[model samples]
Target: MSQRVVLGLSGGVDSAVAAYMLKKQGYDVICVFMRNWDSQLNNDILGNPTNNDPVCSQEMDYNDAKAVADALGLELKRVDFIKEYWDHVFTYFLDEYGKGRTPNPDILCNKEIKFKAFLQYAEELDADYIATGHYARVEHRDGDDVMLRGVDGNKDQTYFLCQLNQHQLKKSLFPIGELTKPEVRQIAHDLHLPVADKKDSTGICFIGERDFREFLKNYIPAKPGKIVDYATKKVIGEHQGIMYYTIGQRRGLEIGGKGGPWFVIGKEYDQNILYVASGDSNQWLLSDEALITGVNWISSTKPEGDFDCTAKFRYRQKDNDVSIRFINEDTIYVTFKKPIKAVTPGQAAVFYDGEVCLGGGTIDKVYHNNKELEYL
Candidate 1:
């Protein structure tokens, strides 16, 4: 009997190709389209409809997904995860921003929804494994599943999947992990897939390409605040809200008619003050170390106590050599080998040893010298 693999088939080139590849491998492929967001259910806090788009993007995506599944001769299933996404991913997203911290919802979405909820759905289908189009690879060795970076360095997505655990990795498959973006597109083209020439989706997951501030205002009430200079402590300008702005953000300050351009250095949550410093690479933005919490170790070979590895504080960032000291079972204090700029709280600090992913944790606090940057 052929192994049955349930695949998450987003209406995009990558996932379309993933579905095709799984079928070619002789697996009984079942394609599922996950509907995780609905603008109708997401009204403003004041009970007014926020989105007014004439055409719904999610519906269009489902149409494309159905076309792909039909062309590939696979069974397509549509599932609603809107409530689960709200409770698990979106709530945490709003809470982190409320605390004046920049959170990566993509990380949490993978941990809670794709691998957890969707994996459960796949299991109920009596499948041997679940697959996606993520550009990452899993290696089974010595009775443990190990995640490795995708072969395409530029398109590697292991950073987002860092929060996945042993069981998730064991049952998961990344069909396009070894292929580059162009290669995946080419395969789709050859297969005459409808999404072969479709543009890749960008911006926040499910939120689509809407104005970020406007979309956020639908959920969190915006409180306008004052923007201050960090070095002089002088009021420079006014801001929409501290929650909308993030550390190291340079655009949309609207503080025009200035001596020069300025970048957000920190945020005072209690005071509702947004702090800025002149110049893009301000010294005030640099940090020497950070305190990480909610750590998850995915590697089969776990390191005890203090250890050395390379880590990326944000996605697409080059790895940096770091020293890690275990503070607790789920926490660590990491000292960067070099002074890294803008190590913001609530973002992930994903660690890697060569190509193998060693798991990671969310950044809780940042420090320069020995003093904590409590303002952020």
Candidate 2:
């Protein structure tokens, strides 16, 4: 009997091509679509009027996924993960925003929903392995599974998958890991997949194309606050809420200031104040060190002492050289070789050792010149 592989067939070009590749590899491919959010249900929570569209985005995606599964002559299953997503991912998202910190829910979604909950469902299906459209690679080396950067440098998604554990990596496969975005699209086109020309989804998966602030306001009531100039300490403008903004945000501040286009320098959560700096390269924007918590090293054995490696504070950011020292089993004090700008608390700090992905953690604190940034 052929090895049965369960593939997550998201209604996108990447996963469509992934299913094609898996089938070509002679595995018994089964497709699974994860329904994690509902726009109407969320609207009800906010007490806001819901859209009248008969078919929701998730349903449209399911239709696309089903088309691809049928085209490839495979069995497709739809699973509901709404409750799990709410408890594990969305709750954390709201809590972080409430605390005046930026949170990457995509990372948590992968950790809690796709990998954890989805993997469990796959196991119950008696599948030999599970796979996704993510642009990342897993290599088995000498009795260990190592997650590596995908071949496509520009589209590498290992940062989001950095929270995945050893067992998850061991059981997961990325069929499109070796292909570029263009190449994946080409394969889909050649296969005549239904989502061949579908546009890539952006922003948060649950929020879709909705305005982020408006979506957030439904959950967290807007508290109008003062936007102050960091240097002058003068009230520049007013903001809707601190939870709607983030460190390093430049646009959307309606400040008619003398000096700047203004970048968010710091946020005083207690005072409900959002501070802005004039220049992009302002001193307040840079930081030489950060304290990260809930760190997860992929390898079972943690490094003994301080070690040199590189890290990315955000998904698209370039790696920065850093020295890591364990504060405890789940914490690390990272000293950036050069000052990094806008290393926001509550955002993830994913570590990398060249192409190999080291597990990462949430950034709990940021410091400059040995003083913790208390404002943000």
Candidate 3:
């Protein structure tokens, strides 16, 4: 009997091509569609509070995923992880934002939902391995698994999967990790998959192409706050809410006619103040050191003492050379060789050793010139 491999068909070209490749590899491929969100939770993305109509995008995605599964002659299963997502990921997301911190829910979703919830469900289905179309690779060496970046740097998604541990890595497969986005699209087109021409989904995975601020208001009540200039400490404008903004955000400030485009440097949650600074290269936004917590080493072990590595403060950011010293079991003090921009608390700082992902943690504190910022 062929080994069973459950593939997450996300109704995207990448996953569709992944399914095709898995079937070609002669594994018993089973397609699973993870329903992680409920569209009935809020109004439409346009901020219309009266619009109670349910969105059909999730249904449409399921249909597309079913079509691909049928084309590949694989059994399709639908799993609802909405509750799990709410309990494990969404609550933490809201809590972080409530604390005036920008949290990456996608990273939490991967660790809590896809790998934990979905992986457990897949195991119940008697599958040997579960796979996703994520642009990352897993390798086994020295009786341990190591996660690596995808061959296509532009589409590499290792940052999101940085929280994954050794057990999860061992059972996961990324079939399209070695292929570029164009190549994945081409393969999907050649296979005549339904999602071949479908536009890639952006923004939050569950929220789909929605206005972020409007969607956020559905859960968190918008609190009007004063936007203060970081340099002069002058109140320049009002903000909808501190939760709606993030570090280094420049647009939607409504502070036009100002000397320069203003970037968010800090948030004072106690005072509900949004701190902004003029110029793109504001010194307040740059930091040379950070304290990270909730660290998960993928190998299930921490490196001894301080060591050199590269890290990414955000997705799509170029790696920065850094030295990491373990402060404790779940914390690390990272000193960047050069100051990095907008090292926001609550966002992850994923470390890497070349192509290999070395795990990471949430940035809990940021320091400039060895002085910790008071606002964070």
Top TM-score model: 1
RMSD of each: 1.7, 2.0, 2.7
Best-performing candidate as measured by lDDT: 1
User: Per-residue lDDT for 1-376 in model 3, tens only?
Assistant: 9989998898888888888888899989999999988756434432656643336378888999999999888889999998787788888888999888999999989999889999999999999999999999999666779999999999999999989988899899999999999999888888888888999889776657777777677677799999999889999999999998888888989999877678888899989999988865546777899999999888767789889999999999999999999978889999999988888998999999999999989999999999997665
What is the C-alpha lDDT profile of model 2 across 78-192, one tens digit per residue?
A: 9989889888988888988887888999998998888999999999999889999999999966677999999999999999998888888889999999999999988988888
Clashing residue pairs, candidate 1?
none
Q: Write down the lDDT of every candidate, Cα atoms only.
A: 0.89, 0.87, 0.87
Model 3, CA-based lDDT = 0.87
Off by over 4 Å in 2: 43-56
Per-structure clash totals for the candidates: 0, 0, 0
Full candidate order by TM-score, most accurate first: 1, 2, 3
Candidate 1 Cα lDDT to native: 0.89
Estimate TM-scores for all models. 0.96, 0.95, 0.95
